[model samples]
Target: MRMRKILPACVLSCCLTGLMAPAAFADGCPDQEIAVETLKMKRAEDSEKAGKLKEAFNAAKTVAWECLGNDAGKRREALIKRVGRTLGDQEEKQGRLKEAFDWYLAAGLEADADRVMLKRANAKPDDTNAVGNAIDHFKRRNNEARVREMRGIAARNVDKWLTAEDKAFAARKDSREELGKARDWVYYAEAGSGKVTERAEKRGDTLATDDARRSIENAIAYYQFADKPQKAKGVRDKARKLGDEHARKGENKLAVEFYSLAGDDAKAAALEKKSEAEKQKTESARQDKFKKDQQSLEKELGL
Candidate 1:
């Protein structure tokens, strides 16, 4: 009975040793499962760096699962780093810049993140977009030392440009105001001239009145300054009509002056011819009447 109990105890001890020896060995060194997972992860990262994306992805997946199963802390860290770098590379190649940046940052590689972000900023879609992207990247890296200075320079340039624009706008506004004042002056001057012309006409001095006539001429000049050529022409025509009427009244010198004032050279010449003919007729009539009277007197006296 004693031999039977000893034999059974020895067999049970051997079975226990068999189980505890492997556990001891595993505890003393790295676990075989973890080691295998680490090797696979390393191979995957190497392949990825060599531009073998598909192979890297497959190997990384396998290592990740194995590391999880083995509950290996160091191996898990390595796997995560490898997978993150591979994802970052793939995202960069595919033009997914933000995603690439996130993956590189997760892998604890800030330098890579910065490089990728700068690339994205450079690939901006429009003029206003690049500044926003560059700012974002610099902020992410905590690199604000020079960013503020750059921002200040940009602000200063904008302020200078805005100042110039404001000056130009003010100059344009002033010009427009001056033009408006000139137009108003022309309107009032024309109205005053019209009133003066009407008064002069009622007083029978429409053509002979120098002051009122001068006002009408000034009014036409002001209308031209106001860019109203049609209105100016109308006023000039009225002045010409009044002057022509004065010229036809047998006022020889006065008619010449009026016709000249009316700018009617042809009418003035005709009127001058008529005046000359009238003078000759008056002289001839006076001579004829004197001769007749003298002849009658001599007959009466029987001389």
Candidate 2:
């Protein structure tokens, strides 16, 4: 009878110990399931920060599903939101604008969806489809105020683009007229005899209006036609000065024509004396300008 009682007590104690062992192990440390899920969530967050959006999305999805499976209501909700946000971000980075917007909407971020839709609408200027889509998204969010504003902006942008196109065409036409006037000035200013006034009237004072090409051409005509050597020298000197001014301003093409009109033979003699003197002056000026510019740029950059 003693042995039977002892055996029954041993069996009961073993069963209780078996039951308590799992509980003891479970209590000794943090919850393994929650710990694993948290680690995954952290991994996802790190990946996201490192710009590995796709991997982050996968990990976040796993965490969200696990939390949901465990019946963690608040945690599940939060994880779902995080997963949706991560996926949406990934889609956006990949240029899947519509997909990203949908995900944001699913995550209950209507404002974010609207913002992305607006960006998408702006990207495709000619595509009315994108604009229509954005409008639909705004409507779904009940953002009537924003929808109306965007519609106005779209209409304004279309009108602005049309006006700009018309202006560009007009500018091109004006440039052609200016070029023709420049050519006429060159012709008239070159003519030595006859009524210089009549020729001048036809071309007008187009050269005086800062038309560098016309001015240079007129200067050339004067150098070629002047009979007296003294008059020629004076005209050539004036032309040379104009050339130098244009060269300093980096208008090399206009400068070349004027310089050529100064006559090649005269230039060769002057070059030897002027080159070294001009170099020293230009270098000094450049150094001063560079220092000033560096100071200005540093201030602008907040460096």
| Inter-residue clash pairs, candidate 2 | none
Q: Write the per-residue lDDT of candidate 1 for residues 134-172, one digit (tens) a residue.
A: 565676657885345334433443334334434543553
Off by over 4 Å in 2: 1-71, 157-303
lDDT of 2 by residue, 56-120 (tens): 65676677434334444355456557767877888999999988988887766767787889888
Query: What value does the lDDT take at residue 243 in candidate 1?
Result: 66
Cα RMSD to the true fold for all candidates: 26.8, 21.6
TM-score per prediction, in order, is 0.30, 0.31
Clashing pairs in 1: none
Give the local distance difference test score of model 1: 0.58
Q: Model 2 Cα displacement at 293 (Å)?
A: 97
Of the candidates shown, which would achieve the greatest TM-score relative to the real structure?
2
lDDT of 2 at 301: 100
Report lDDT per candidate. Answer: 0.58, 0.59
Best by lDDT: 2
